[model samples]
Target: MTLAIENGSGKATQWQKVMVVAEPTRESAAALHYVLSRVVFDNDILYLLHVENPTFWKTCFKKQSSSTSREGGGCYGGCIGGDVDFLDQMKSACEVVHPRLKVKVSRVETDAKEKAYVIISETKVHGIDLLVVGKRQSLANAILGQSINGTIRETAEYLVENSKCTCVAVQRKGQTGGYLLHTKTHRNFWLLA
Candidate 1:
């Protein structure tokens, strides 16, 4: 979904456009929604993607196979209702806040490693001017080391580091919100000060 907000300051400047990557996680989705509401931008597009990593599922099933033999039925890591429902909830929340924003959702059939590539590829393909993502709390990220941030940092780090588009990482505060904005238009890629 694309939402255009005129800068309340009557300066008459071109509104900047941004593309937000939506993951089917409650915390991540809520964080993005909070950031979007707080940020004063002109146009915003929401790209919701549900990546089904067959490899990850295979690995998970492999781990459970031996256990299942001893126990009754093995745990099949396929039908994830939580992830599916989270996306729907996020879509509804976005619509309630920014009815005009254009929202697009797609199912990605790729592993975690390839998911980053797909996201970056789609970003370029869609001519996205900016990329916005939710940042997990440091503690949560450390506990779940192989998180989306780590994947992006490892796989698409170069793309994110060298791309000409702007990238913003938003995190939730006690009740408010905080954001880290980085502009990669100049010297390679560096964090915004």
Candidate 2:
């Protein structure tokens, strides 16, 4: 799917508001950082968003309630700390590299489908000029039942199919660890990771 992008009036094009779909993984973190480093302008506002399954909290609650650990000790694996930490790291990197950029973080609890809708809606509401998403696995591999990214890959596909803003899906090349495929942004570009 493609959106009708209005070209700048013979002036240099700059993204003002950029939103990156983030997950608690290396690929997503890399994608966020890559976009911040390559596309964001000094005055741009960057939003780092993560859509989490609400059931994750329920499971964590159950684990904490039935825990064998001491009071105030809970399941760190199920906590949102990892996600928040990842965002913080990205924000710090952005500040260091693009000192004038503003960074914002948001965590939304919802299912995959609702997550996609929320992303699209938020982009429109925030007037985002660029939307970046990271795909954990190849689309072909995911369709072949080798899914690793799971809901994240689906959310990325949904954004590619439905978002009205310029959307880029960053996919990591296997093993090589330095090649990235930027899908669905007028032209497909490969970058060294």
Candidate 3:
């Protein structure tokens, strides 16, 4: 937990390392992208983290060669390595929006039910200052209830409740099909769409 001294205010502000939880869904990326567009500092590090479930055998060994980027609407090939397609897209999007910001990608394998715990552990180990996650409706929510994407939302909520660092849960404005433009200065507050 390093404190950065501000020149004007003469106050110490902690805004160095930030971690964003990335999922395969576009909403997840968009939420992270929204965060990136709003927050910027002189020397900040952005971490993109994706947790994979061992139970999902389909993506366990799906490796592609170091070829060109994928066409149409699919994962990019050989972006970070093989099989880390989600991180690839996220990194690319963040670079496009904030080219100067230092960005890193991390992929972890964990139990299906322990995603939140893994993220919290990583945040502590990495000395993260903020943790950002996307909130969206999952397919299971349709079958179960319509509050949120059950597992991921639960993970975000747990992080918000228990993490030593700050936590932010972003959601797309689905009703009006808008975006969350501002969440930096207005902590826990969101703009329309």
Candidate 4:
């Protein structure tokens, strides 16, 4: 079955707070595009949640310009590195589709917690009605024997099972095919256009 999206803005529905875990990945951008173009309504609040992993800094940045130490090279603070550009593009696309939609940027640190747990916490704290995250299979996943189809990595799976709000883990099927959608009750369901 396809993922159902109701765009009945004329109906009397509660204002929704929809959060999408934004990362600098093709799958993440696809998820954002899906939500902006389908799931979110004009009155909904869209939140882009970025969880900064300190370990990522080791490979991505040289120094901490805002808070602490400089490690290897350049500065990185208040930025999701250069990937924030993609985030801006996603926001612009959302605005073009939903001019009245309110998009909020939430930047948080993992703070040594599991990323999934951090996401769940944020969902509860924000009282989100819906949450979306990208699902992708990596080489490490294959080596770890997590080569299951339609099942996302640990983060999306854990978020789906534990988050307070309804969660969707999605991977784009192709440029025009639609998406591979997963939810608490659905796994690897293909939502074709």
Ranking by TM-score: 4, 2, 3, 1
Worst 10 residues of 4 by lDDT: 70-79
Per-residue lDDT, model 4, residue 186, is 84
- The candidate that wins on TM-score is 4
Q: Model 1, residue 191: displacement in angstroms?
A: 15
**For residues 1-193, what per-residue lDDT tens digits would candidate 3 score against the true structure?**
5567675887766558888888776667666866776655545788888887765534433422222434332334222333557677778877887777788899899987888899999999899988888765457654675235444445655666678887776767765655643232443355654
Candidate 4 per-residue C-alpha lDDT over 2-112 given as tens digits, one digit per residue, 9 for 90 to 100? 233455875544578899998777778888988977798877889999887877666455444443534433543333544347567777878898999999888787753
CA lDDT, every model vs. true structure: 0.55, 0.72, 0.68, 0.76
Give the C-alpha lDDT of model 1: 0.55
Q: Name the runs in model 3 displaced over 4 angstroms.
A: 5-15, 58-84, 138-153, 174-189
Lowest summed lDDT over 10 consecutive residues: which window, candidate 1? 184-193
Clashing pairs in 4: 62-73
| Most lDDT-accurate candidate | 4
Is candidate 2 or 3 superior in TM-score?
A: 2
Per-residue CA lDDT of model 2 for 1-193, tens digit only, reads 1223345776554547889987767678667767865788766788998888878777776777686764557656425422257667777888998898888988888884588899898898888888898865655654755234554446676687688988887875664555465556443466765
> Candidate 3, overall lDDT?
0.68
lDDT score for candidate 4 against the true structure = 0.76
Error of 4 at 165 (Å): 1.3
lDDT score, residue 164, model 3?
83
Tens-digit lDDT string for candidate 1 (50-118): 666877767766666656353444545232322356567666877677776666665667867666667
